[model samples]
Target chain A: MTLLAQYALTGVVTGCFLILATIGFSLTRQVEGFLNIAHAEMLGVSAFITWGLNAVAGWPFLPSAAVAVVATAFLGLAIGRVVYDPMRRLGPAVLLITSVGVAYVMAGVMHAIIGTGIRSLDMPLATSYKAFGLRITDYQMVVVALAAATGISLALFLNRTKTGLAIRAMSSNPELAASRGIDVRQTSRATWLIASGLAGLAGVMLALIATLSTDIAFNQILQILAVAILAGLGSLYSVIAAGLIVGIAMDMSVYWIPAGYRPLIAFLVVILALLVRPQGLSGKARS
Target chain B: MNLVQLFLAVVMFGSLFSVLTLSLNLQYARGGMINFGTVAYFAAGAYAYAIVTQEPPSGLDQYLVGLHGPWWAGFLAAGVASMAFAVLTGWPTLRLRGEYLALTTFAFAEMLHSLLVNERRIGNGTVGLANVERPDPGSLGLPDAWAYAGAAFLLMLATALVFRRLLASPYGRAIDAVRDDETAAEAIGKDIARLRFEVFVISAVPIGFAGALYAMITTLVSPDLFTAEVTFFVWIALVLGGERTILGAVLGTMALVGFQELVRAFPFESVRAAEIAAAGEDIVTGILFILILRWQPFEAMVKRRAAA
Candidate 1:
């Protein structure tokens, strides 16, 4: 019983991490109106920058993470303006395929720079706290706290600011938003930075909890896609719910099944969600 | 990695992958479906062949079934298996459109991969099935590489001819009509769903045959070899050749495979050098993909030739 409870706790942490990773992807799909396949590679970029600074170059973790996130945000904006802007004349399908090329290029650069090996941030060991036979680590707690903080702040930003209103308007209908005097270029740029910066933040949380290899970020794309789909591809609030549902389902399944089948849980969730509720938990038609 | 060896390798792999690109071309360009899980069908075929032709389980074998059948029977089974998988996946997914279809197919493929890796009763899990039986090409007084290359070419040519014939018919026009405008096709009494399902199943057969040929060429079937990377490579090839033409599909696959072969041909002194070269190849291939898509040089060429 305690084991199940413990698994659930870990699942929530996993769920929180997924939320961070997927928000950026969902944001891109909403505003830019295309799935960015390179979004996962952005996580790799930020994680590696953090790793390079803290582990390889002997900087403290906080400063390294801040720099990595900021750099990743700006980099994503640049790629957007340069690679994706002109291609807007093309449809979403073409843009999706183009992002795969972007992913390949970004992954190659990271591979050339980082090489193949396990890496981690040069930080203190995780301090585990146990109560009532349940355990949580400092880093895991950080992930959960950051997820909540980001979720709240993002909600406030979206609801309370003029730019946030512009973003929302643009995502729902880009032409309508433009005709209403929203700056198309500025909103698009904001979307890229925020989305990419969120990915960067997720990368930091990833470095905190898990051992990193060059391929680790790439490995998460499927799981991230699963979460995104369950959130109805472009919906925001449901990402939290979908993330936890998948994360807990995956972790808790390990109690009854072989550990090797854990990844299968995400896939099963995706298939079922897509089949049963194509519009997903958001219950709103994106089209 | 001599020039002769490189040429043969490109022809062999280019054709095998061309089978996949050709099928994708049918699904995407004509049927208006984006089936991103092409590797799963290919894997289904390979595994079916491996299981059918391998001898019954012996010492240390964890897999549950092996038919000990002949190569021809196994080849037939490969095609049937691929069609079966396509039916299973396509029936549920044909209702979805665009990126949703793409992601569902991708999820299905990953699910199958996990099953193959974790289910020890299926091809001994990650260890995979080796020493898969095949008829010796030497019986025909030909070297193995040359015989296999010829076999791949024959398979590719057959696929192209069949698809070309299918598309040129009235039914093919119906399929095109559906893609060009779904509502108009429906208005004309064309069953959009049925045409899609049929094309989805029919195109899968050649890929299964290609998978069987691939297993014969490599003499092995492993979870490692059938990854999303295979799917991505086929998509890139389709893009390179431009869509909606059999000849373009072939040429594009040949060009992409030849490019990779050229990079691999160079000898290296250290592992680092080799790794860097591989990375460089990825970078260049990606750049080329982006550039080609941006300029659409192949599409432009096709249009110009048509006008002239």
Candidate 2:
């Protein structure tokens, strides 16, 4: 029972981080209709930016995170404008290749700037809290709460706000949305900003839990891709659920299998997911 | 530099890349499968050859089992193993369309990398296998470089001929039909899945063969050789050379690989050119890919060919 509880705790913690990282990808895919391979790199960018501010500039945690989020949001907006806008006119294959290229460029630039060395975030370790005989770190709790809050806010933004509705309209049918005077371009830019900012927040939270490395972005991006696909592309709720499942499964496998075999488990899960639910959990049936 | 030596070197490089590009083009151009795990088969071939010919380590020779197969046997075994793996994975994953399939294969490739890097017992982990013997060219009396280049050229010509025949055959037309529209092909009595699986296996054989040759050429096999970057580079070559054109893949690989070597040789003081050279290959390839896709280079080439 205790072992199960331990696994569950670890799973939830890992799931929380996955959700944070993947929610933005889910949103952006919904808005843009293509997988943004550079999403994980943007997360890395935010984490590094936050680290620099906190470690070098001596800023407090909240202030640094805020600055990183803003910076990432702007960067996301710029990417949407400069890279994606022109490519949107091309076919899906072209866009897919371009996003991959953009991802390579972003990863290269990040590595070049950050010097390719792993860096530890200097945030004070959060105290552990016990709930129902299960130990939970304060950071983990904060991450979960923040993720939930962000998710709820996003739901409200999509369903309630005029601009969010416009974004949804655009995602559903860009041509029709444009005909309805929805300003598809503006909505896309806004979606990029919000989605990438969320990714940044996830990155900061993730870096807090683990050491930051150049390859972290690529690894996390792969995981996020899996999560986004399992969730069926655009369904935000399904993405969260899928993220939780993958995280828990990954954490639980460590107990039963050798550490080296951990990656194979994720690969197995992804392959199985592709075989069983190619369209993902909530994806629309292809015509 | 000796003109003969330089010419031989370029030919060797060109032939090796031609092999890589042919396999890539088979999937990307002919079958419309965006395989990001192309290097997995290549790595598998290299490792297979390495394992078959490897002697036990000095300290553990008594405890661990070792194989001492002929080099030709090892190479053939590598190709066969790679083909088997491709068939196994391609059966299920080929059903997926577009990016999902790409992402899944990419994940599989990464898994292969991790498995190779961590499994010290089976393969030597990250240190990789070394001191494998190269194929002998005894009694040919030609220079060693010329001999190797000659053999590689023959292999490249053989591969090109085989692929051209395959592409022109009825089965090749089936592969193209499946790529164009799976449902339509299915309606027309073609088993889309079966054809895809066939092409997947066929394409993997040459890739694996090339990989085995690569291990022999370099006289080593390491986890680093099977990176996503290598697969990406192959993708770039296939795209730049005009997919579906056998000769184009050969030309494309030569140009891209030559450009990569040139970039590495250039004096760039600002960016750790080695590191950027490592990363820049993908960046340049990606840029070229986007450019070629946008401009439709193949269409223009075809027009010129028609005019000629």
For each candidate, the DockQ is 0.79, 0.47
lDDT of 2 by residue, B1-308 (tens): 45565566668867876887898788877898888888888898888888787775666322143476888988898899798879777878888877777887888888888888877765777777778766677666776677778777888898999999999999888888988888899999998877877887898898788878888878888887778878777777777787678888888888877776566555677656567666766566666666676676786989899999
Residue-wise lDDT of candidate 2 within A68-108, one digit each (tens)? Answer: 99999899999888777777766666676667677777777
lDDT of 1 by residue, A56-173 (tens): 8999999999999999999999999999999888889989888889988998888887788898788889999999999999999999999999999999999899989999999889
Taking chain B only, the TM-score of every model is: 0.99, 0.89
Score chain B of candidate 1 by TM-score.
0.99
iRMSD (1 decimal) for each model: 0.8, 2.6
Best by TM-score: 1
lDDT of each: 0.92, 0.80
lDDT of 1 by residue, B1-308 (tens): 78889999999999999999999999999889998899999999999999999999999999999999999999999999999999999999898899999989999999999999999998999999999998899999999999999999999999999999999999999999999999999999999999999999999999999999999999999999999989989989999999889999999999999999999999999999888888888888888888878788988998999999
